[model samples]
Target: MSDYDVIVLGGGPGGYIAAERLGHAGRKVLLVEADALGGTCLNVGCIPTKALLNAAKTYEHAKHGSNLGIHTSDISVDWTELQKWKAQTVTTLVKGVGFAEKKAGVTVVKGYGTFDGPGRVTVRFDADGASGSGPAQRAESYTGDHVILATGSVPVMPPIPGAKDNPHVVDSTGMLAVDAIPPRLAVIGGGVIGLEFASLFATLGSEVTVVEMLPEIVPFMDAELAPMLRKALGNVAFKLSCTVTAIDGGSVKYTTADGSAEAVEADVVLMAVGRRPAVQGWGAESSGLEVSGKGVAVDDRMRTNLPNVWAIGDVTGRSLLAHAAYRMGEVAAANILDPEAHRRGEVMRWGTIPWAVYSIPEAAGIGLTEAQARAKGGNVQTVTVPGAMSGRFVAENGVKAPGAAKLVYDGDTLQVLGLHVVGSYASEMVWGASVVLETELTITDLRQVVFPHPTVSELIREAAWAAKA
Candidate 1:
């Protein structure tokens, strides 16, 4: 039995990052994984999907290249080549993550790790591969002083009738791997993932129909941004306040808000409902851990009920975002190494976290919305500007597209409370607002910072200046 100071299970973004941090802090660390190191975000979820989306975007540009005075003929999408490129990109990045782990002196163990006790883990693996052929082919067990659970979440497959049996139905993972674009794709959820895929498929000539259970698509975002996104996805159809009842071979039966059942013909049904934390099959029960339907409960320090056994990332159910998981991992590693470092209690401020939906006209925001601030009983003021004012937007995507920016301020203190943007490269611009919010910068403080002319970032500064005025 090998022993280490820290043993991280599930070497995804959270676990691997924690292990690297712990190892760098002069603690002996071992990071174990059943699959790749970068987890879902790098391997299957975020990176590859974005690559595919970029390809679709390029395809769309090429298809309409003639309108832009770029004469192009016989523009075609090579599916096999696109898949190969996406796979290569994923491979390169995943290898880089593994290389970083090794450079950080983290012992990477490949297998399924089960918690044997509070600080003990037994890693089991099949003896068929390279690690199995030699003397290292057998299952192994290791004990550590501190254990971190970073097992990520998987896409949730809804329990709709006939949803599972149909071959036309595909989850986010399968949808990303699809070699051929469907002629007509029906997306079940109107959240980030669904809308992203809808944008991709619609731009690629797929008759896309997004059926959202909520009243609006991207329901978690500001309702004001929804209209802009809806206008951007003019090609795609939306059935709001709808519930999917059943999905047969090529038809989806759904109930409208009016309680009428209707079936839509679909060559492909993409399920983008959401993802649930992957907490099962890791011997969480043996550790006397309490897991709600969402995920394992953790305090601000990421500590579970059991001492020395903590959870982070999607497993904690706080925020399933990769960056959120990375932050939690850093906190967990710091708290584990030196308990007194962050004992003053840290706030999981969701407002400061930048949220992005990678639709065609991307929507992103940092800090509180106008409605959220007003609900908090603050005298809130807001300012909005059209995207056409930004020369960058006009230069890159042209002035024809519509975009807007909203800035919210505390009326009493004149502090910048929130920044919302819905337009071209809105996701990119939100990072600037994130910095302002993280620093707790007032509207006056933001106004002091000079922004270069003809840039989208200027919109953020302009919005802040307007709010202050």
Candidate 2:
């Protein structure tokens, strides 16, 4: 039996970050992880997907450089090399996580941890970490003054007929490491995951189709910006308000919004509906942890109903994004270290959390949409600026590309309530927008902030000026 100041279960963004913070704060910490250190984001999810997408983008640029007067011949994609690069990137980042943990003086235990009691856990060592050259591994009991759960989430594999039996049907994880790019790909969801994969394959010469159940893709995105993003995703077909009925081998059958049955023939079908929190297993019930269908119930401070217990990141289902988990971990560590400040209302800010989709013409937004602001029933106003309005935007991506910035404001106060952008560097620009929203910077205040001349970010400032007009 061992005891520690803090014991963190799961090594995803949330758990690892919380452990690092606590360890750095001079608390004895134990981090238990059964898999790689960086978890899904650095392993199969965000990191690998972005690496492939970046390669696809480079390939597209090389093949279509005629517009920029940079001609190239024999441009090609080598899948083997692409996979190797992604693997190397994942390896480096995972090692980096371990190094950070070591630097923070966190003792890492490789195992599956289950709650044995309020402040206790039973860890069944991973196969590689087992001892004594025996088939039966070792299980150890440990106690902590405080425990944090950050188990993360898994992709939702909905029960559609023939989906499980069909080899062509693959979830996000499976789709990431496919044998080769299918000539025709049928994506079963139109959210960020599906749309990103669609962009990646479409750029790599796959005939792609995205079928979404909702009226629009990316349900959280601004209604006005969603269509613009869809338009920006060139050569990808989108079928909105559609429901998947079944998978017939390589074909996907679904119902259209008009009450008609339809099927898309493809060499592969990607089941990318979404992810659900991994609330089951690892002893939530035994520990009396309150968990809803959504996820482990937690307040803004990442506190659970149980004393000295906390949950963060996707496990809380507050936000599924990696960046969101990072912030949650910070808040949780702070609260744990300074219970006095935590009791004084140090809570996580749900608003001002930015989101981005890293497609070819990336899309990102922070704060409320126009409709959301209007629904709040106060004086609301919005202004739009085309991406071409910025000289830098025109110099890089021609005027023909789909690009725009929309600013939603509180009319009475002239305070910028929301900022959304669709076009190049949209992802990079949204963080600054989040800062403006976080600090409650009004349009007038934003006007005085000198933006570097000739940048895509200037488009947001332009939209701010237009709001006053």
Candidate 3:
């Protein structure tokens, strides 16, 4: 039996970060993880996907650079070399996480942990545990003053005939570890995962088709901007309002919106419908933790129904992004360290959370969309500015490239409610927009703020000036 100030299950972004903060604050911490230290984000999900996308983007730029007065002959993608680089990158980051945890004086246990009761967990050390800095015992029970659940999520596979046993069909994880780039790729689900892979393979000379059950892709995005994004993704076809029915060998069969049966041939098929919170198989029942279909229920302070037990990240089914998990970890750690402060301490500011899709032509949005803002029946107004307004965007991407910024705000108060962008640096620039929303910066306030000249981010300032006009 081992005892600590806190027992953290799952060393993903949320879990490891909370453990690190707690341990640094002088709390004895035991961080247990069944897989890699950096979790899916650093391993399979975010890091790997972005790495491949970045490589694809490089290949695309080299191929298309003739328009920019740069000419290169025989530009080709070396898949083997690319995979090696990706592997090296993931390895370095994972080792960095392990080093950080060790530096914070955290006891690392690489094993499967399950809750036996509140603030009590039984860890099963299988083969993965042999590599950890824990006891040699095959199984051990650890008790702590507090328990934080950050088990994260898993990919969801929908029941489609022939998809279950098909060798060509793969999930996002399988797609990431693909042995070779398929000549033809069919992606189901027009969400972030599907579109990103579609953009990647298409840029790499694959005939890519996206079949979505909805009328539009990225339903949460601004409706007017959705088509612009679709147009920006070159050489990719979209079949919206379509349902995938079966996977017949390398053919993906689906029903169109008009109930017409259609099929597309592919060398590989991606099942990117979505992911579900990993609420099962972690001994939630043993601890009697209250759970919903979404995930582990937690208040704004990241506290569960049970005393001294908290949940964050995908397990809570709140914001599942790694960055959101990072913020949630900080909030949970602050509250855990000062329990007496209660609601006065740090709490999650969900409205300020931002989301981004890393495609060739990236897209990012923060806060409510135009429709969402109007749905609230407030005095809503919106303003849009083209990326051409920025000298840097025009110089780099050219005037023909698709790029725009849209801002949603209260007409009466002029408070910025949302900001959406589709173009280069969208992912990098959305954080500033998030700060604008977080501070409730009005259009007037935003206009008064000086923006660096000749940058893509200046589009936000341009949009603010347009809103004021």
- Candidate 1 lDDT tens digits, 63-94: 87777788888888777888898999999999
Model 1: runs farther than 4 Å from truth? 129-138, 343-348
Candidate 3 local lDDT, 1-469, one digit each (tens)? 4499999998999999999999999999999998889888999889988888899989988998999999999999878888898898899999999999999999998788888778799888755444344554588889999999999999989999999978999999899889888999999999999999999999988999999999999888898788889889868999999999889998999999999999999999999998889988779866789999999999988999999999989889988899999878888888889975456748888888999989879999999999988889989999999889999999999998899999999999999999999999999999998889878899999998888887899999999989854
How close to the true structure is residue 197 of candidate 2, measured as C-alpha lDDT? 96
lDDT of each: 0.84, 0.90, 0.90
- RMSD per prediction, one decimal? 2.5, 2.0, 2.2
User: What's the ranking of the predictions by lDDT, best on top?
Assistant: 3, 2, 1
Put down candidate 2 lDDT per residue, 229-287, tens digits, no spaces: 99888689999999999898998888999999999999999999999999877898777
Off by over 4 Å in 2: 130-136, 343-345
Decoy 3 TM-score against native: 0.97
Model 3 ranges with Cα > 4 A deviation: 127-137, 340-345
